[model samples]
Target chain A: MITLPDTASPLYEKVKDYILANIGTGRWGKDRKLPSENELVASLGVSRMTVHRALRELTSAGFLIRLQGVGTFIAPPRPQSTLIEINNIAAEIVERGNRHRSEVLVLETIMPTKELALSFEFPKRVSIYHSVVVNFENDLPVQLEERFVNPSLIPDYDKQDFSKTATYDYLMQKTPVTEVEHIISAIPADAETARHLGIDVGACCLFLHRRTWTGAVVATISKLTYAGSRYSLGSRYSPSKSS
Target chain B: MITLPDTASPLYEKVKDYILANIGTGRWGKDRKLPSENELVASLGVSRMTVHRALRELTSAGFLIRLQGVGTFIAPPRPQSTLIEINNIAAEIVERGNRHRSEVLVLETIMPTKELALSFEFPKRVSIYHSVVVNFENDLPVQLEERFVNPSLIPDYDKQDFSKTATYDYLMQKTPVTEVEHIISAIPADAETARHLGIDVGACCLFLHRRTWTGAVVATISKLTYAGSRYSLGSRYSPSKSS
Candidate 1:
């Protein structure tokens, strides 16, 4: 049993809110069958049309699933990656109610190649901090992150233990990032990345090339790869009122 | 010789602007090598470090490619899909200075299945308009668009000539879309999609599922597939001042 919010919103919206509250409170778990339209209409004292609209909209919003000839069920939880935000992998996983862990594979200070120097806008042979970390969601490897940091921005980048604290988390605590750019592509994983992610060689992966700036100086550049089979990246858009 | 913009921007930004202007004005075509660091320093009256920073940032931005032991060269144009906007395929191609065309493969009325009825919130047995259009960029098939439309929203949906006016364009003119949601994923293409896109079967494809709403009614549901080898989607983000 649920109580609808008393407001000026339409009847369908109230029904939607009530249904969402039940889901949010964990009264209905993932893949649990939801009440049919007739049951909802009877419980909420609304018309069948109103209840149908509520369920349909929730399905469209990825919160519910409706199978033909079968009752509607709660959709399985999806790990949603925000398209417009430079999100830390650990934060994203934890936000989805999953435990996040990391394994540090490579961390060292190395001399930049000519191409790397050009990428960092630093002089040739300058030392930069490089690290490779594999992020896991409840023991399943999800992301392989390879990052290069300018030594000038974070002098002690190599001293931190990334398995305990994510690199992005550490950087955010030290300085304010002014801007971030992302280049996204789908690529076949090479042998190394495939091995780390536990996917077969040549499996497709979502590749994200990201660069962050701290007041016009490049602070970090990273190439992050996610297993395409288990992960998806998405965003939503609503036209402004003026438009 | 190109004249630089006289502004208060940093010297490196000004140099970057000059190089961009040359590329924009067709002075440096795709894959064309630009003047070396020493040559640019001598001509622009700027230090070597300034020129290095400008070129390095441009490469990071995907505007240039730097090769070791070789001069910098302009990168080939890439088709970038906006992550936040519900962009029309024709418009996206034309915006990239490329020719756009479409081949309509399937266009007819379909009886709504139970799943389709649930998706549209309509009763089963209702007829809906369905279409499949293959979008091309300079004759190369790039996307296979499969769509289902609520016939009540647009009465004459099947009569429109999609080659002359895109289905998305027509829908926009007929109704005011209130909200748009997107779900993005990566999957291997089916045999039919691969044959249509001229790619090998089992090749990875970028899959986009989009649904647009008119008020509370679902106006359209679309599944757009793009060749992963040729396309990538991206968006930019900047932290708000309040954040």
Candidate 2:
């Protein structure tokens, strides 16, 4: 059994942490069902409600699963999302049990060249806004976000304090989105990208390009990349209809 | 430029496939933006509607992201999900341009042992249903699913033909779910699991243990293991109201 936390901490969080730690350490093997809820209540010397709360939260968070007539079991371990908050990247990292911060690399509006014009579907004379930001988790550079904003859609893009608020949150609030798109890929870190992410050149990094829309007008686009060693990808599947 | 299909196939699907192939083949580097719908329409001799359809699907599937005033850019690539489906696992393989099949290793109802009884919060006199199944992709064993069903919750589970339908789908249709939990981990494959997944014993395999529920009553529990090489995990994140 894993050690529990002091009594001062929330009993449920303590239980959740204990179970998660044990699972990470492999004290419980794969496919091994766990003790009952009543048993957990007794062993942890916590109230039934407290034990249930911990179990419930863990279940929702994808750490433990319970069956109706069957018992609960430890779930397989997965990657920890450095950013899991409802907010954008800055808030996401802070919620990951790490200190979150950022620095503005480039913040400007510029004209698109011929290739850029063709890419943006804009006339050759039209301008597009571009921003590059480096996000840090616990003082360690982890992600490079290269952003291109539609000037026509977000005219006041420079008014917001991106450090305090994420572009994702701002755009989401300002625009009622009717569509969202993402593209994910893997590539070796290039010199510039590697430097921004604090990863050695040639190391693998995962990239996510995201675009959001309000009705038919495009709202914003961003290229976010993370160091491969620092992250893993994960998703869940249910046979039922998805939300 | 992605090669457009000859219009013999689903136009949108073919276009998506062409774009995906280019991304997979490294034609677009990290942060590299893609051509616009107009360019694709003019160059491929396809209608803008067709190009938009393809781009729209790829964007939804996380292949490309678009900015309103800016052009569309290639999204970062993430890991691919090979076996995280709640639908029939066999179907997923076939859809991936590969062959899939399964072999049942064990299917029986047995009296609950002490450990099993304690896990399910059931009396030792009750019985528990168990099954072991191995699934293959392209004739290579890729997954081992060891599951335990609550006899009380799923009384006729043994009569179901799992070879045609997954237990998850069956349960979801028969008993509507009110709650479900998922756990993911990495563990060394046991001899049996290793043999099923065609990996050496002690090699790392991704594992998932899931439990389903209808209201407060427990439904079923399943422990599944997969060969990590063939199965990668992925998920998407959007700044939602909860964040």
Winning candidate number (lDDT): 1
Error of 2 at A185 (Å): 7.7
Best by TM-score: 1
What TM-score does each of the candidates earn?
0.61, 0.44
- Estimate every model's Cα lDDT from 0 to 1: 0.79, 0.66
Off by over 4 Å in 1: A1-87, A121-125, A241-243, B1-87, B121-125, B241-243
Q: What would the per-residue lDDT of candidate 2 be over residues B61-128, giving only the tens digit for each residue?
A: 56678998898888753221122213345556776899777777888998867866665655456777
Off by over 4 Å in 2: A1-99, A104-148, A156-161, A182-209, A222-243, B1-100, B104-151, B155-161, B182-211, B217-243
Candidate 2 at A102: error in angstroms?
3.0
For model 2 chain B, where is the 10-residue window of minimal lDDT?
Answer: B78-87
DockQ for candidate 1, C-alpha atoms: 0.21
